[model samples]
Target: MNFFKPVAAVALGAALSASTAITAFAADTTLVISSWAPPTHGMNAKMWPKLTKMIEEATEGRVTAEIKYKLAPPPAQFDLIQDGAADLTWIFHGYNPGRFVATQLIELPGYQGSAEAASVAYWRAYEKYLKSANEHRGVKLVALHTHGPGQLHSSTKVTELDQIKGMKLRLGGGVSGAVGDALGATGIRVPAPKVYETLASNAADGVMMPMEGKKGFKLTEVAQHSYVMPGGFYRGSFALIMNQEKFESLSKADQDALMTVFGEPASRMAGQVWDEIDAIGVEATESTADNSLNTASEADRKAYDAIAAPIIEAAIKAATDKGVDAKAAVEFIASDMAAN
Candidate 1:
C-alpha cells in the first residue's frame, strides 16, 4: 500500500510540472510597465498605447506590454526598472538631479523646431555624442525624447518677462532650474504629477512646462494664463527604459525585432504624440473661458536671448565634463532641426 501511494504522488507531480511548462510556453511575455502619469495624460493615453502596439507588431504578438500607474513616484522610475519591479518605464531626466548631466544637452534653451524635429535630432546626437556618458547605465534605453518647448503657465497674469522675479514657480529641474534663476524666480522642485495640486493650493505661482500640460494635467483650469516665448524657455528631456535582464531574456529574434521599432522610431513616435497633445493643450486654452495666452514681445525675446546664452554655455560645459563635445553636439542638433 505504501509503494502504491508513493507512485501515485510521483505521477501527479510529473503531470503538474508538465502542465506548468505548457502554460508558460503558450503564454505571451507580458511586460508590466510602471507609469507615473495620470491615466488621461498623453503619455498614458496615446504614447504608451502606440508603444505597446509597436512592440506587439514588431515581435509578432509574442510579447506585449501593459501600463500600471502609480507603482512608484516619478523620480523612483529608474530605480524601479533597475530593481526589476517594472519591466519598463519613462523617466524625466531632470527629476533625479545630478544623475543626468549629458541629458541636459537636449533640455537647453533656444533649439528651434517642433518637438518631433528636436527628438529625432536628440536620438541622432545620442548616437554620436551622449552615449559615452553612460548616464543611463543600469537599464536598456529604448528611446529618448524632448517635449514641446517649455512655457510659463500661471494662475495670475504674467504679461512681461520681468514679472517673473520673486514668483515661486514649479521648475522641473535641469536647465529649467537655471532659467528660473536667470529670470529671478524662486524655484519649487516637484514631479509633473504634483504640479496641478501645487498650483491649486497656491504653493506655486506658475509652472514652466510644455503646452501639453494645459490638458494633460488639467492646467487650463487652475493656471488660467500662459506666457509663451517663441521657442520657449526650455524643453524637458525624457527617456523610455527597460529592464536590462528582462530585455536580454527575450528570444534573440524578438530582441532584434524590438530593436527595429525602438530607438529612433520610438523617439519620433513619442515626439509626434507630444505634438498632438500640445495642439490639444493650445485648443483647450483657447476655448476655455477666461484663459489667456500671451506671446513675449520682441524686446523680451532679445533680452531672453541674452539671458539664455549664458545658460546654454553652462550646459555645454556640463556636458563637456561628461566627455561629450557638447558644442559640436549642440550645433549638430540645431542643423538637424533646421533641416527638418
Candidate 2:
C-alpha cells in the first residue's frame, strides 16, 4: 500500500505540472502591431522582432506582438492604435508636422551623435520634458527614438552646396522641409515609400533621408550621389506607442515587466537597429557602380550653420508657446547623447 501511494503521488505531481503548463499557455496573448514600413526595413526586420522577443521573454509568454503590414498607412497608425484596431505601432512625428512641436526638439540639425546615442537622448528628454506637452495623448507611449542623421541624396552630383539651389528635392517633413528651403530647393512632399518612384520619374532630383535609405528605400538604385554634413541636416523623430486600453488589459505582473523592458531599453534597441542598417546601406552604396557618399565642405557647413539659426529660434519660440523649455530640452538631449 505504501509503494502504491508513492507511485500515485508521482503521477499526481506530473499531472499538476502539465496542468500548470497548459494554463500558462492559455494565458499567453498575442498583441497585433501595425507597421507601415516595408517588411524588410530595419524597424520591421530587426527592431520589432527584437522587441517582440523581449516582450515574450519578459512576460514569460504571457504577452507578445506580431507586425501586420499594410494594416494602415503611416499617418493613420496613431489613430489605429488609439482605436485599438492595432495594439501597438510606431509613428514619425515629422509626418504629422506642427501637431508635435516638442518632438521637433530632437529633429533640429547639428546634433553630434549616432542614432543610438540620439535615441537614448530622445527617450530621456521625452520623459523628462516633452511628456508634459501631452503630444501623444491617446496612446500609451512605449519609447521615443530618432533615425540617423539626414543627408542629401541626388541623381546629379552636387560638388557645391549652391549647386542644389534650383533642384527639386523630396523632403521627409519636419525640419527636412526647412532645410530644403534653406538650401533653396523646391520641395516635393511624399511618403517615404514613394521616394524611389519620385526619383525614377524625375519628379524629384534628390531626397533628404538617413543613410539607411540606400537599401531600406532602395535609393541607391535611383539616387546615386550622397552629400552629408558634419552634424546632419535633420533627424526623424519616431515613437513606439500602444493602445491605451490594450495596455491596461494586461495582467499587472505582465504590465510591470513590459514597462521595465520599454522606455530607454526599447529606445536604445531601436537606435542600434538604425545604426546597423545605416552601416549596411553604406556598404551597399559602395558596391553600386555610380553611387558615392560625399562630405560637405567646411565652407558649406558654415553656411548651413548660418541658415539654421532662424529655424532653431523659430522652433524654440513654437515650443515655448507650448510651455516646454525647448532650449533646456535641446541641451539635455545633447548632453544625454554625449554622456551615453
Candidate 3:
C-alpha cells in the first residue's frame, strides 16, 4: 500500500508540471502595434523601436511586438485600436473631443509646463484619479504623452495678439480651435497632411501646432514665420492604448513586462525626445530663406491669456456638468506644475 501511494504521488506531480508547461506555452504570444507615422517621425524613429526591442528581449522572445507603420492617419488611430484592427496604437485624445471628456483635463491651458513633466503628471492623474470611473472602459492605457509647447506658424508674421486676429489658422482639434477662437483667429480644422497645401494656396494663413510641425509637415516651406508665445497656451494629449480583449489574452508575465516599459519613465523619455526633435525642426525651419521666429511680448501674452482664461473657465463649467470635479483637477494640475 505504501509503494502504491508513493507512485501515485509521483504521477500526480508529473501531470501537474506538464499542465503548467502547456499553459505557459499557450500564453506565449505575439501582439501587433500600429502607428500613424511612417517610421520616420520622432515617436517611431526614437521611441517605438527601443520599446519593441525591450519588450521582446524582456520576454525572451516569448512575447513579440510587430509594428505596422502608417496604418492610418492620426484621426483614425483611436478607432483602429479600440476596434481591434490593431492590437495597440497611439491615440490623440483631442482628435475625438467629446469621446474622452475626462481625459481632456490634461489639455487645459497653463497646466503643463514641460512635456516631460506634463506627461508624467498626466499618467499619474489618470491612474490615481481618473481611472476609478469608467473613463477608459474598453481599452488598456499604456501611456499618456504630449508634444512640446504648441506655437503659431504662419506665412506672415504675428507679433502681437492683434496680429492673430482674423487670420485663418489651421488648428488640429477642439482645444486648439478654442485657443484660436480666444485669439480671435478663424480656426480651420484641416488634417495635418493638408496643411502645406492649404497654406500655399492661401486657404489658411497660419497653423497652431507643435514647433516640430514646421519640419514634420514641411510647413516651413510655405509658412516661414513662427510666432512663439512666452509659455504654451495649450498642449495636446495622446495615448498608447491596447484593446481590452487583446490585453486580457496576454500571459501574466508578458503583461507585467509590457507595463514595466510604460508609465512615467517612458513618458518622460518620450517627452524629452519630442522636445529635442522640436529643436531640430526649429533649426531646419530657421535654415530656410525668409523663415524667422519671434516671441510675443509680456503684454501681448497677457492679452492672449486673458482671452484664454475665460474660455478655460467655461470649459471647467462644462466639465462640471459632466460630474467631474473640474476645479479641483485644474487646481491640482496647476499646483503640480508650479511646484515641479
Best lDDT among the predictions, by candidate number = 1
What is the RMSD, in Å, between candidate 3 and the native fold over all Cα?
A: 9.6
**Pairs in clash, predicted candidate 2:** none
Q: Ten-residue segment with the worst summed lDDT in candidate 2?
A: 20-29
Candidate order (TM-score): 1, 2, 3
Worst 10 residues of 3 by lDDT: 21-30
Per-residue lDDT of 246 in model 3: 86
Pairs that clash in candidate 3 = none
Q: Write the per-residue lDDT of candidate 2 for residues 1-340, one digit (tens) a residue.
A: 3798889999999999999888656547899999988999988999999999889889888887778988887888888899989899999987887788888889998789999999999988888888889999978999888999998999988777888898999998888898899889999988888899999999999999999999999999899999988778889999999999988888899999999888999999999999999999889889999899889899999988998888888887888899998999999999988887
Q: Estimate every model's Cα lDDT from 0 to 1.
A: 0.94, 0.89, 0.77
Query: Which scores better on lDDT, 1 or 3?
Result: 1
Q: Model 2, stretches more than 4 Å misplaced?
A: 1-27
Q: TM-scores across all candidates?
A: 0.92, 0.92, 0.86
Residue ranges of candidate 1 with Cα displaced over 4 Å: 1-27
Task: Give per-residue lDDT, candidate 1, residue 218.
Answer: 93
Cα deviation of 44, candidate 2, in Å:
0.6
